[model samples]
Target chain A: MNDPNFQNDDLLDIHNLKTYFFTREGVVRAVDGVDFKVKVGEIFGLVGESGCGKSVTSLSILRLVNPPGRVVDGSILFQGRNLLELTDAEMRQVRGNRISMIFQQPLPSLDPIRPIGDQIVEALLVHKKMDQRQAWKHAVDLLNLVGIPDASRRSHSYPFELSGGMAQRAMIAIALSCEPELLIADEPTTALDVTIQAQILELLCDLRSRLGMAIILITHDLGVVAEMADWVSVMYAGRVVEEASVNSLFEEPLHPYTRGLIESIPVLDQDRKRLNAIPGVVCDCINMPAGCKFAPRCKVQIEKNMTICNKHEPHLLEVSPNHKVRCWLYEEFSH
Target chain B: MRHTQCNDGQSNLKESTNHILVEIHNLVKYFPVRSGLFQKITAYVKAVDGVSFNIKDGETLGLVGESGCGKTTVGRSILRLTRATSGEILYDGKDILKAKSSDLKSFRRNMQIIFQDPYSSLDPRLQIGESVGLPLYVHGMKNAKQRQEIVVAMLEKVGLKAQHLNHYPYEFSGGQLQRIGIARALTLNPKFIVCDEPVSALDVSIQAQILNLLSDLQEEFGLTYLFIAHNLSVVKHFSDRVAVMYLGKIIELADRDEIYKNHLHPYTQALMSAIPHPNPHRNRQKRIILTGDVPSPLNPPAGCHFHTRCPVVMDVCNQGEPEFKEMSPGHWVACWKVS
Candidate 1:
């Protein structure tokens, strides 16, 4: 998304965003010093394993962080407006109007008590100035747009009554009811079968092109990111360890964590036995490493015995054009 | 520095004689959907409707299908965990479906299941030790000290320590719990195991670790598996032979390479193409995207079950069921359009 043509079209600019949870035990730095930019109509991939704060970053952007968890520092700039400075009412105007999220589990996120069409109409009525009949008609149209067959008939069904794929489509319909400028899809297809996942991914890409909405796709599956994202930001332990264009990231990943994460997956195209798994478990965030958060499980750091990786944390620096890495190994290239 | 699949997860290594370990013939399991008063049977769910496959000795047979496609039921029926409506499940040349209770216990010891849901599969109230050790106690491993020693040894085999014996299910991560489940399944040294989506619930990093561990254990123990899952890549990377199921029927079955390189069935092609390749260059538009949902199993479309969504459907496909013919040696497909 850093292409010269889109250089001035940064839709969402997040600078040093730090979200922390002050639990009873201690202050958990769930999202510490994260920085990225999502340009207009560009897909920004935020990838990590579970508990890596990918979801938390999305929550922070929506200002959904509740008590005991707060955005402690930094600013989130959306379309020349600093969202952090806005009051709750002002932020509400943006939430679900300008931006919306599609959760992992559609059944739980969707209102089970009411018909899915009503849910979409509710969002429409709130954002779009339309009567109930018009909203209901628009809701059915949204459902049809999301590829739910026989939308008019299916719209009357409750969340639980619909199949997993249909429920996901309904959720997408609701998310699209407002025609959001930015859609944060957090593992939108994780619970779906491969065929259904393909359908949903196709729908997302089609919607992006048609509506020209920027998407922040948060997922653990590299395959999905490879197919969908234009730029990728690989997260490790609440920090963006690497960010690069899709081709550059895959071709020459600089960060050890990013390489390990990519290598660990069993690729469909490749016929290789025994993956290069990142040894040791994900580091405990409460007692995070003093240096690189990924140092303990990092093969390169351990192999080279880079003392700095254990003693001092490294900051993300541009190593190649449009490619940023946070590792001492690439410190020379950064300078 | 991990050579083990525990990094994510393998295929091939079916080198022992092609002796069939377990054989299933016309396996049919139908759950009667009842309604109204007196619990009158309205219609059958047709869960594992007329499905069949053979697992060769020490060879992995991957059973791949979407949810509610009768893959789990097929696994359950073979193990006798759930009784089949009508089928012939032969274990080591003897039909176990006809086995008496006394003899059935022996068959149960020979075959076990590693469930999909790591959390719900194991009893929450029981310590992992007790949960893993329960099978040993059931099979008459009476001495408590001996059971503990065996449990400890098995736990260590799966990369866990003896100290984790007393920890409950809640204390362990998903990968560790799967490991524990594997250890328990292997305690009796079962010749065959049904891995029901064992790695589906875990994270990507942990999934690799568990997969590698499963492969390593299979080689070491010479265990045959009916690996059931919907993840095509995982299945292809695992089983020596892959069987693709659709609407309670095996649409295709072939060697690992044959299935990927030379699949004939339209359904299989759609399925293989649908798997989001890790590489992006293969555009999504190139896939054979099948329209419409999988028809309900309760009343599967007559003729070819996949005809409703087949890209190259024929008039004959809607007339009668296509024979599961041998298109090539060892490669099976059930589609008239394959010709």
Candidate 2:
């Protein structure tokens, strides 16, 4: 991904991306000046809990931010080309051709009445400019690629006929119909059972390797991130709290938020008496405080072990060769 | 936190009668599928078939399975939320299935349910105060003013602000809403509550909050729970004993620690393996991918329902139904190979 022909070091470089939602009350800064880069053929996991602006960032990348929710700042650069500068038509070509996105729910995304075959073919016909017959054939091939059995017969089946796992496979097939360069999967397995969820994640990894496609997987599950992500970006209250390679992030997470998230996860090996949860809920995104978003619930800060967290929002500074953390503890430790 | 130590071990060798609070015997609930204008009974979809377990008083019994595995059905049947076609549900030495209407009302006071979706489970139009106190209103406990006071007390009990009582269900976050839901179930001072995927709807950060709240509330209230969820991790945390349901039957039921440490049932093993371990250092074996989907319960496969996908399936697994038997002291399994 960081190869010489990487075309300015990133497949997707989002600089100071800001997505705000205008409600009757006030503007909710769903995503506020977040920056990260995804390289070619690499899986960049955007990790965050609910209401942390991870989904908004992905939606902004595709210019799918609807009314009331608007990208108010910064640029989204892919392969040295700015997406914001492109026309709607150009962006249309970009979507499903160069970059495709698979949403969390498959049923709502798919037209219930229409057969899945036609819908998948639409992705091909619209993006690839393929003939009807060719698109249909390609659609079936894509379905097979995602491991949907009896692709030929299953193509004609409606979304309702397919199970949740199968419908998810159809969505994946549609996403990969045009063989996009990059895929943005938003909580692809959140609703699925562990068995089916594992299968889906495995399929994503397999697809990435086979197609040499870069992926930006947005999820809260640290296990999914660790398993698939080459690089991981931990988001908390509309900010990139930490960014590191998957190995580095897991081995030595610098940010307290990242550490908390990791520790909160029920580890299989340890016989934990109680979950070490970061006490207190996530801050309401609408009325964020001036200081670090995680300051209120931080144990170290409460103990006065990390005083800087309360006064200033630390920038994501490099703590290691490939790891970056935005935390006062890291700053003090490094100093 | 309410701390009542009750062992809900499956009935087996050295069976302790004291631990058994609710015993289900050969429970079967089948929905008749009809076709044509005449509505002829074509087949029966067995949602819960030959499922049995005993829940100890003041103990959390975790029932885990994939969607449509009859786990929810098991919970609903126990509470008589859904009428079971045939089964003996022995609750504290009384058969509730044969109880009268007025007796059922008394049974309802002891048993309650906390649904999965907090948004839908709580009425949108009602205030948190009225919603939590609705049972009191139905039972005619006190006037509106007194009911409001009790609701506020319950709200504070679940870690919600008393002021938030005036707010609608839409006002609170998912976790807080679940807390309200919990508060609603607890307002009646129930002995047992069926928690069906209570924390699954919440975010990971908030899940712990609700789980901790449930644990604390259980200890405080001396409550028993038939905790059903897809998340094995949370189940491990809250449950004293765990039951793994598949298709329409309980494949395995054992102590939480024993199940996690040494799972006997093939289905349980597969489910455990499938759980993505957050720790990257502990590289578990690639999940045992169960080949094929769960067979339609309308006409479940012959013999062992899991034989279609079981990796180590035997000849007998396809010929006859595997007997649900006690494999160890408290561990109960229904597999032919687990001698």
Candidate 3:
């Protein structure tokens, strides 16, 4: 079936994507009807707190959702092809060859027993059909591209021997060894120190410009999103509550949840006695509340007495140019 | 060259208020790195290498650095959780490092700590009430009823309800678990607390709540905090003064505003620039991206530990360790080029 929300220019288009975890307790709607699009060469940021389904959505795109956790509905269209329709064998061709992913913790993602060089060579060998010697040389080049000093010497070292920053760089090298069209970096810098994080971010931006690859940068950090993302989608309770250009999202955050999240982060310049914290805890994914999932924790809902927010679910609607919000307040502004 | 002269102004100011609650002088903590079956100590990982700082009464002193930079070690060493190799930790004039077992017990009553990860820190088997009241119980609060009352009150202070007391650690979320951790830390009514990356593991919104809660508690109880975190922005927000550590040593120390406004040390400047500002438009300044990871503490680079990565490195920086001298009234820096 053709997805109504599909766009021809989109490198990755996700429409009504619902990924749920089937547990004995109940179905946990992890990525509950989420929608977003990533244009070619654009850095699309999927930002949210832990358990908000940002990672699940990324996994869904790659069709990496393991059993018990499956994408129940939605079309993940990539370059006119539906990723969900592709069989496991068919999907293998698309995995590392066309799309690649880097995880938060680099050490565990890499094989500790194998030399870093062999791992990158293995990725090249599996996907690129390169000989062992050619793959080894390509691995060294990839390592050098990621700014790993003395690439040849360092490639011989195991994952355990490398520092956090070096390991992350090596992970990036492996992710980019095939020169994939899209790179999904899941909290790539979250595990590193501030200085190292800066270095890694610079490297990613540099790699993007040089490699001309579209990226889906998934992180919990708003700051990282602002620095790197061209467009951003803020996820809450497994849905895109707000989607806009990076500047618009930061300046005029439409959703109350989005506003709270932006205000919650303590910036280096601002000095306030207390941060504007969103009241109440995140709603349970297993037995989610009806209507707006954020209504229970929303200050606007409480103050405005928006009873409809608790009764009817709000649809993501475009309120302005390139800005969309899934909120009852903007229900009137919907097209 | 000794930079003792730099502290003259600080010493005079110290006498006027005499509010220096915790004064760490020449503090050093080294962990032995062993190898082979014999387990002979080959080298020492200089965790807290001759670090010195003063935490005033009723003020939050932020200690920030990358992981493995020994920020946690400093906090742990000060609390005597892990004994310091050598140092003078003066808590209101009495040296805590030299305190006897009896004295240390009393010291424990006055000092408390909140760990980073709420998941592993609290025991899953224990009920929330028992964990919160554990400090009180250990401190000779023999009455279970009184302990329960204190735990309930503390939980309320941290924005948790009385109903939460009966729940296990597994039942609560990360934010709620953090609140329980804070409640436990405050249960003893300690004068000083070490909050080690309390909000780092939490979400942004939850971090705000916990930070506000910490500030409110500080106001109510007049608690002094050594807030240790790697997040520079959070440190700037929550701390009265901040210390930037690199390679097991505090490279810079100054008032929060002073440090943020005019950082003398190159390492400090790089760290400030490294923080990805939430507002993209505001971050037009060219970020000073430092190269390479922090050198291993076991065999740190000779001279200034940061010399290898410093954008403005000099020959002298690689030759000898720079003295941590006060550049301004309250701003202290350890760099040869700063002067």
DockQ score of each predicted structure, in the order shown? 0.60, 0.60, 0.81
Candidate 1 segments whose C-alpha is farther than 4 A from its true place: A1-7, B1-16
Evaluated with DockQ, which candidate comes out highest?
3
Cα RMSD of predicted structure 1 = 4.2
CA lDDT, every model vs. true structure? 0.88, 0.86, 0.90
What does candidate 3's lDDT look like per residue over A1-335, in tens digits? 23466557688888999999999999999998998888999999999989899999999999889989999999988877899998888799889878999999999999989999999998899888999999999999999999999999999999999999999999999999898889999999999888899999999998899989999999999899999999999999999999999999999999999999988989888878889999888888898998999999999999999999999999999989989999999998854
- What TM-score against the true fold does each predicted structure earn? 0.95, 0.94, 0.96
lDDT of 1: 0.88
Better-scoring candidate (TM-score), 1 or 2: 1
TM-score of 1: 0.95
Q: Which residue ranges in model 3 land beyond 4 Å of their true spot?
A: A1-7, B1-18
Ten-residue stretch with the least lDDT total in model 1 chain B: B1-10
- TM-score of the second chain, each candidate in turn, equals 0.94, 0.93, 0.94
Q: For each prediction, how big is the interface RMSD? A: 1.3, 1.7, 1.0
- Candidate 1, residues B156-183, lDDT tens digits: the string is 9899999999999998888889999999
Residue A171, candidate 2: alpha-carbon lDDT: 95
How far residue A278's Cα lies from its native spot in candidate 2, in Å, is 2.4
> What 10-residue stretch in candidate 3 chain B is worst by lDDT?
B1-10
For candidate 1, what is the interface RMSD? 1.3
